[model samples]
Target: MTFENTKEFAQQLDSQDKLNKYRDEFIFPKVNGEKVIYFTGNSLGLQPKRTKAYVDEVMDDWANLAVEGHFYAEKPWWDYHERFAKPLSKIVGALPSEVTVMNTLTVNLHLLMVSFYRPTKSRYKIICEEKAFPSDQYMFQSQVHFHGYKTEDAIVEIKRREGEHNIRLEDVLAKIAEVGDELALVLIGGVNYYTGQVFDMKTITAAGHDAGAIVGWDLAHAAGNIKLELHDWNADFAAWCSYKYMNSGPGNASGCFVHEKHHNNPDLPRFAGWWGHNKERRFKMEPTFDPVQGADGWQISNLPILSLAPYLASVEMFEEIGMDALIEKRDRITAYLEFILQEIDKEVDSTFEIITPADPSERGCQLSVLLHGEGRSLFDYLMENGVITDWREPNVIRLAPVPLYCSFEDMYDFGQILKAGILR
Candidate 1:
């Protein structure tokens, strides 16, 4: 659909959006009694109104029963952690038993590393994108160093062929072949946080598997924003945080998925904890720890219900809308945002270049715009006018218009604001 920079045209598009009503579901941040057109759901999502009610139910249950809430409440605390299974399973496209909502992003990443990244003498290496999140690079480096292996030899970093911002699928497949024999595991972020580029999980998984290596994903920025079928893709394991597009509160619970294919594979190692032990004898205080089946077997502790309440609220919305439809709207919303941004750039001196892919299917909702000429000041100018996008290091400003909360008007309005901010 072609667009022009007119308020009437923008309103008409918003009017036709089948998911238009969902904008009212979130608590929009206000600036001088005017709703701020928030487009940062890629970094953090707006809170759902039901979040309070969900938390209240858990609080009231705890208030009334205190210690016994673990066993007696309607959503028993003893089984509180398990409540996340079915809903989280749907989000990442996995079986219920293959997922669990647990520790934060980095912690889960560390735990999965301990299990999957076992470096041997002949085949003792890991492969990851060159510009991975700093935390992940550190985690990968430490894993190799702890086992008396040099980080340089034990980790293969794939760069984007010099001038590129995103990796091509063919390049990734070729890398797997080139490094296949010596590679132990391929741990990649499902989406590049800086570039807002969504990686092709199915093809990458196939390449890694064919190369005789395990493939795991860090889905920190991809989970709720993208439609994923981790099980069908045959991903060995994956982890994601809930605070972003999932609308879970800040530092809220995180989740992980382990494919059913690895459920009982004796070769797959796990870091054991009491909660991962067999439920029948978990509280029996047995000396030996027998892990449960599936991804629940990866769980380490009883859930923090207070932390999980926000996710329950968000997942209920996802269940109602169905994620497939969400992605359809997401693609439209993101494509509109990108089209408008580029169109706006055309109006200017071509000062801004998009680092994320133009293909809607290859990206989530976010657009990473690289503003030339002292970029941080340009981002500051947008923030001064209440245009709330996130800026990564150097010069990239990320704008994500979440379909669940953003409008076409929001996209155009931001485009106008950005033009005024930059061209002036």
Candidate 2:
């Protein structure tokens, strides 16, 4: 499909877009009395207008029923989280029994590692991508330290080639093989936050298992943004934050996955609490912890219902639209965004390099642009001009044209604003 840097062309694409109506479903911030063109869904998603009702339901229940809301409210607070299992399972391609909603991303990762990251005398190293998100980096450091190992020795980072922006699949596989029996766990972000590269999870998971290591994923960027088959891929465990592509509010509850094969394993270690205990026996308040089977077994405390409310609202929205529809629009709109960037670069005679992989299968909605002659001022200029985007260190601006709410018109408008910012 040929893309033109014109309002008419963008409008034509928008007219044909089945998901275009969803743009109105979200509330966008205004700059100079106009709704800003949003490009930061990869960072924080715009709130759904329906979110208020979900929250209000909880608030109303608390107001009227008091403590009894836990049992008698419309969507009873005690069983509130159970609503997410079916829909979220569909989104991440897992069985309902294999999925649950719980703590935030990094916290869940740490909790999951207690079970998946067991180290031995000879096998204690963990393999992860070089320059992982700072939180994950810190988590790895702390986890290895807790288990009494030096950070440098216990963590094996698969690095990109000097001039390359993305890590090669072969390098990752080779690293797993090289680590061999010494590898205790293979934990990587399914979608790299920096370069927007989507790793080959199925192959990597298989490789990790073959190398005698447990495999897991941090799906913060990949969860709702891409197609995932955690069950079919046979990933031991995975966790993702809902506030990004999932469109839940800030710091919302996270979704988790644990394969059914591990459900019946009573010996698997985890930090447990009353919520994770068997629901039937929970009121009994027995001294011994009998964990609820499946992903719920990993919960450490009673859920924060308010946090789960907005997430349930967003997850239901994903169920309504389905991932196939989202990915179809994602691929086309992201390509359009890339085309617009290229067109703008040509128009401005500026050197703008997209570090994200060109293959549709290797990226999601995000396109990270490396500005050769630009700096922070351009990012500031974009922000002031009603283009809400994210700027990383050096000169890269991350743009995520989220299929749910962002439009082709937004992409074209962003190009015009970008050109103006560069010229100014």
* Best-performing candidate as measured by lDDT: 2
The RMSD (Cα, Å) of candidate 1 is: 1.4
lDDT of 2: 0.94
Q: Quote the RMSD, in angstroms, for model 2.
A: 0.7
lDDT of each: 0.86, 0.94
In the range 1-424, model 2's lDDT, one tens digit per residue, is 8788899999999999999999989999999999999989998999999999999999999999999999999999888999999999999999998999898999999999998899999999999999899999999999999999999999999999999999999999999999999999999999999989999999999999999999999999999999999999999999999999999988888889999999998778888889999988888989999998889888878889999989989999998999999999999999999999999888888678999999999999899999998899999999999999999998898999999999999999999988898898
Segments in model 1 whose C-alpha atoms lie over 4 Å from true places:
none
lDDT tens digits, residue span 267-324, model 1: 7778889988898889899998788887778778877889988898898788888888
**Pairs with steric clashes in candidate 1:** none
Cα deviation at 341, candidate 2, in Å, is 0.6
The TM-score measured for candidate 2 stands at 0.99
What lDDT score is found at residue 103 in candidate 2?
A: 85
Maximum-TM-score candidate = 2
